[model samples]
Target: MGETSKRKRKRNVSLTPEDITKVFEKSMERASADIAKLIEAITGGDAMTRLGVELEGMGLDRMQVIRVAKYFGNKPNQLHIHIWNGLNDSYKPDFVKAILEE
Candidate 1:
């Protein structure tokens, strides 16, 4: 029966800010793992010096570097686009290619 009666009531519904925070926290958790793996790849014994120099030359600090890695780890096939669009002219193409190859 479609009987329409105006009744004002407060129901528990998801709020925008709450939803945003929940998603943000979830993503942060995933990014942590991505960052850890990327950090290991960057600072591992053999690649340490070259990796540090290349990242530093691009003027990115540690956190930013991790974020970039997380971004790439999330969608590595788009590495070329990310390197070109995100790093501007600070990074060497060959260096980026080498890292992506690894």
Candidate 2:
């Protein structure tokens, strides 16, 4: 019985590359929708001028700003802290300071 239980536990589920790709694509689509909704909520439908301009003024390049926005968009709470911790140290302090000042 012990050996049978071990064998059952050892069964592995395998995913094909195509399966992985499909899952990834679905996840990306969901994430993109969430980010867009969050941005709209934050900017009140004025994303280009409000959020974009502000982050740009903070000296974050396009990609960095996108990354920051992803954090803000996806995680309105503690999840953002984990994302923030993963940010590069170079701009992290400045970004935090500027945000806090607001």
The CA lDDT of each predicted structure is 0.56, 0.65
Candidate 2 lDDT over 1-102, as tens digits, reads 699898987896789999999999999999999999986665444533454566677777777777666646555444444445467757665765565454
Worst 10 residues of 1 by lDDT: 1-10
Compute each candidate's TM-score over C-alphas.
Answer: 0.28, 0.37
- Write down the RMSD of candidate 2 (Cα, Å): 13.9
Model 1 lDDT tens row, 2-44 = 3333232334455799889999999999999899887665544
List ranges where model 1 is wrong by over 4 Å.
1-15, 45-102
Model 2: which residue pairs collide?
none
RMSD of 1: 14.0
TM-score of candidate 2 on Cα atoms, chains taken together: 0.37
lDDT of 2: 0.65
